[model samples]
Target: MMMRIIYPILGMVMAFTSVLHAQSARITALPLQKELKLPASFETAVEKIQYDLLENENGESRIEVVDENCLHIQFIFSTDKAVKQDDWQVSVTPAFSPSFHWAPHLTPTDRHIIDQHVFRSPALIMADGRQVITLIPDLDIMKKGTPVRWYLDLDAEGNRLVLGMSNSRVDDHVLFVREPGAEYPAGEVEIGFYLMVNRDEPSLKNPFRRPLEFLWKRWGHGLYQDGNPVDADLERYVEHTYNWAFNSWAENVWQEFELNGNKVGAPVFIVNYTQSPNYPGEVNEREFRSVWNQAWFSSLRSAGGLYRYAKRTGNTDLMEKALLTKELALSFPQVEGFFYGLIGTEMHEVEIDGKKYNRSKGWDTHYWGNSNRNPYTWNAAESPFHILDMSWTALLMLRWYDELEKDERLLRYAEQYAGSLLGIQSESGFFPGWLDLHTLQPMAHLNESPETSMSATFLLKLYELTGKQEYKEVGLKAIDAIIRDVIPSGRWEDFETYWSCSRYGSDYLVGKKVARNDMYKQNNFSMFWTAEALLESYRLTGDRRYLEWGQRTLDEMLMTQASWQPPYMYVNVLGGFGVLNADGEWNDSRQSLFSELILQYGKLLDSDEYNERGWAALKASFVMMYSPLNPVTKAQWEKVYPFFGKEDYGFMMENYGHGGRTNAEGEGMGEFTIYDWGNGAAAEAYNRILDKFGKIK
Candidate 1:
């Protein structure tokens, strides 16, 4: 009898162990459910048994459940007074779907899913003529292992409210509302139940906790993973180049200047020429000089500050630099509450001192000047394009101000700049690509130019902050105008011609003579701008077409690089250049490769392969430019008479040929470029990438 009993117990233990092993092997699995819902009014007499309720001594309410197939909820409220009819709102969030794995810092065993909406009320006019908003979920159709809860917030006076809900299978939800020193007619509000569910479960932690890890799971991320280490050599080169450009010998110069309080007339000025445009053998010496001087002292100070910030404390330094830059930039007199681009010259100059300079002398006279002879310049004041550039700079300042939290002046200036730009809007709900600086009239002839796209992007950001419908409308209209005029008309070939014409309103400029269109088949910058615009619009509107176009353009750009070698990748300390063909061949003597790599890196947060390729390209170009010794110096020197007298292109280019050796032997000893645009772009790219991929919490 004892042997038989022992045998039965042993069999039972073996069976239990087998069951545990089976469950462990499938730990990531979740129950599949068709749907779940909670009616807007919980008035429906439906029966579901998946809940428990508990009442505390303090009159607080708690709801609990432990089912994989259903969510349970309960409500408790004070019965001291009659409830107000329409003073409360209900909200329910369904479990997030786990289509992808959790990010690095998150636990894979925890719930992870996308939040889905169930119900929202239409604009409801209250009896008192006030608008009340509300939403609900249908609980019966929720997915398996989903968490459901209800929220109640009083729009009017409420002394105290306490509510809590949790599920053994999911995370907890809590709501607390308190209004002190307020009295209202004694009333009680009926608490109702609302349920919501998606095909997946909601995550217990914040979604953005692991951006890079999540990014790696996306289709693009997988491609990047496969290609990354294979391009390790290139990555090393890029990282080395970036280090030299932003953190090496050049950085030492900046640090020395900073140590001296950025005093004027330092030896650093010798390296300043690199910040200006370099055009070889050009007869127009004056033009070249003008371009070089355009890198004003103030701009250099700001750029240097930014570089320091990037290399040091990312946030603290950035905040300080942003404030300083804004203060300095705004100190310049405004033509019409806008800073001028250049000094002394009416052409390309927005303003000088307090006087309104002649707009006719600029690139487009009528847009920015008082002259009617050149309608192109007439919209200078309302040039959304120019305004957009300022806005971008201001936005950067604003972001830093938000980080610092102590400087009110920086925040105030940023808002002032943004508001001034917004004031230029026309009656037709359109922001002209160009504006008449004198009259503030829309330069309608410029068409829905690239400014339309860029402005839309900025407006969207503004809308998020301000919650103003006008901003949203303006942003949507700009996007719509572009889609209607530019894309549908097949004017992709006319990449440079401004499409907003007075007669045609905003239409495609199919046959306009713009050098951007004539020289290159596609303006690479425009494509990037448009891509960002479309993606941002899609984020706001959930319009698939915007996403589709963005993805298509992005894919095209990425795939094109597979075939061709980038030309003169060492030009312009910054990454990127103008005009890339479908095959990835680029033109333009001056290439901003640093900007290109950084820009592409920003986009790579969403794509794995693109990110990998971007890193590879960035590494290759960076190493080639900043390596200690110029490997090609001897090769190029052999071509010159008396090889000992050969020019060191790398050293000369990096140091602006100032205080640098010109012979191959002195290659690694040259001074680094100081206060150059390349440094700024590199700093910006590094910070941006670090923000996206760094492990900091």
Candidate 2:
């Protein structure tokens, strides 16, 4: 094919251009420094920040500071400044909390300008080996004026990179201070700069089969503090999840409710680990997103996961609970075309530029389309249209129903849902994000959506279940739509094909302190049946493009795969910053099927590297789901959220460490955020992988 030929030629050209540019580029590493001062009115209670006392420290080093938050401040004193101000042109390491080495869209844009004193989040730049490193200032500290001021000297030498910070040579270094307050803690800050030297510059898009040991060694951190030997034990993971499930059963995460007066057991997973009626704040009201106070489509995921485990280990205690998931699909309210949700329609208003567009929208996330009238402030930004979750749930129902053939009613439900999905198929393979349930008019669809279509697999299932060529036809058409977007175009490259609802990928989000998506463009969520959909299509259709696109996504994901090391669990492969944020830093998920997709990739590619990596990912997911000490210590987790058959897991301040977005409101992420659905999916994947491919020793 022309693609096979043209791809290499393009790569070679880019490489040659990069080499030429590198050769001609003069590296003038300017010395950078800034005095960062915290204001007096700083909040007392904060996230993971630590301060420690030095042992028998001298007068200057022993500045007594008392603060509630942990300020594990590491210091590199002024006396021991490595790169002096005079010879600072060689390189400059920055002083700040070392996070993921994100792309330094390191340009300075002055927002908080006090008169002529513009507050610049001077992105501290350093040259480490061949890679140019940008030390991003954490969001908490970018606003304090001249103290946050940083300027550099690079204009004299062709102005390659640092002109954004300074037009003229001001200071080759930066000074930092955590200004004085009762809570701010009076202290002489001994600024320290940590350099994340490049050990291996693996191309972000290629090289799929590298060992995780290297990834752990270079990127992973802190899994052995308690001296617990690291073990990627699938059995152990399953056991821990089993305990979690049984505990939740006792807490009544699974409840009996009346739907259509049939007395259906809710058998659902609550969206938040801390979902309580008493709690009503931005973190609470807004955070409890998924069908609060009841169960919905997503609730099926955990049950599906549980079913997978039961089949794997021959445990049938939870079989009833798992089977109860049939209610999810069965109870869905049939609407104009297909099954919309379990509830009726509600009005959704989006006010853009002061114009309100209010329409009766079909339910997607909240329970059965019923808001449950849970008290909270609502906004247009809280868009309620998730095609992927519904698609996955529908597909899951069909798969389970067909595989078992136990419940004929559920089969009817699945068939109805499938036909409904057919009704909404867009000409361009576009699944409208929001739909006016009454009119059934396309209100809007998210371009490069975070939701992946189940059309291909669902169609195959429909064809198998009913022998319908039309279903297959629609499925192929949907696949075409996806392949069109996934394959690199003249406007976008293959790299951007790790595409989401937004056209602008993570590459554009580098250096931005606040992760926001006001532009509302193309974005992506990895765990959304994205790669799996294509690979599954490839399996059925034998379409090389499906595999190629799937492989392309897998390889590009290799690029975003964390630089985090061990004991530092909690990677949000599920696409973080919540429902609206298609892509953003720090991800957490309850989509249990992510690992299964990885397992499928390994088998399809026949690549040991993928198998190994997939296993590692599953293991890490297990740890994130079960390990109490990952981001929160056992004591901390147990104190607030006692794990009594209740799993304590969430994003855990593991923001960019797991996932990020170009434009996200915030990490609607928190601690002890475990969902049984994801647990089930994880368990299912773990079992399948274990049975298919034993531990890679």
Highest TM-score, which number? 2
Error of 1 at 390 (Å): 2.9
The TM-score values for the models, in the order shown, are 0.44, 0.56
What digit string (tens of lDDT, one per residue) describes model 2 on residues 1-697? Answer: 0000000011111222110011111221111001122322221111112112121112121111112211211221122222112111112222222222222111122221111011111222223233333222222222222121222221112212221111121110111111111111123323221212222344222222232223333223232222222354556656665665455333424454456555444333333443322223212212233322121225565565567667756877776666655564476676643554333224456565666644334223234452221111133223243444445556766766765446677567666666767777677774654454446555533434424355566666667677788877777777677667543320121112222222333445322232211112222343234566677677778878777777765543433333233122223231111212223333333223444565677787686545544544565454344354333323333444443222432212222222321112222234434344345446666665565566534
| Tens-digit lDDT string for candidate 1 (209-255) | 12212222322234334542122333233334334433343322222
- For model 1, give the 10-residue run with minimal summed lDDT: 1-10
The C-alpha stretches of model 1 lying farther than 4 A from their native spots are: 1-323, 342-385, 402-411, 423-430, 489-521, 556-606, 620-626, 629-677, 695-697
Total colliding residue pairs, candidate 2: 62
Error of 2 at 348 (Å): 22
**Candidate 2 segments exceeding 4 Å error:** 1-232, 266-268, 271-297, 311-316, 342-367, 370-386, 447-452, 486-523, 526-528, 566-587, 590-592, 625-669, 672-674, 677-681, 687-697
Top lDDT model: 2
Clashes of each: 62, 62
Error in Å for residue 454 of model 1: 1.2
Q: Worst ten-residue run, lDDT, model 2?
A: 1-10
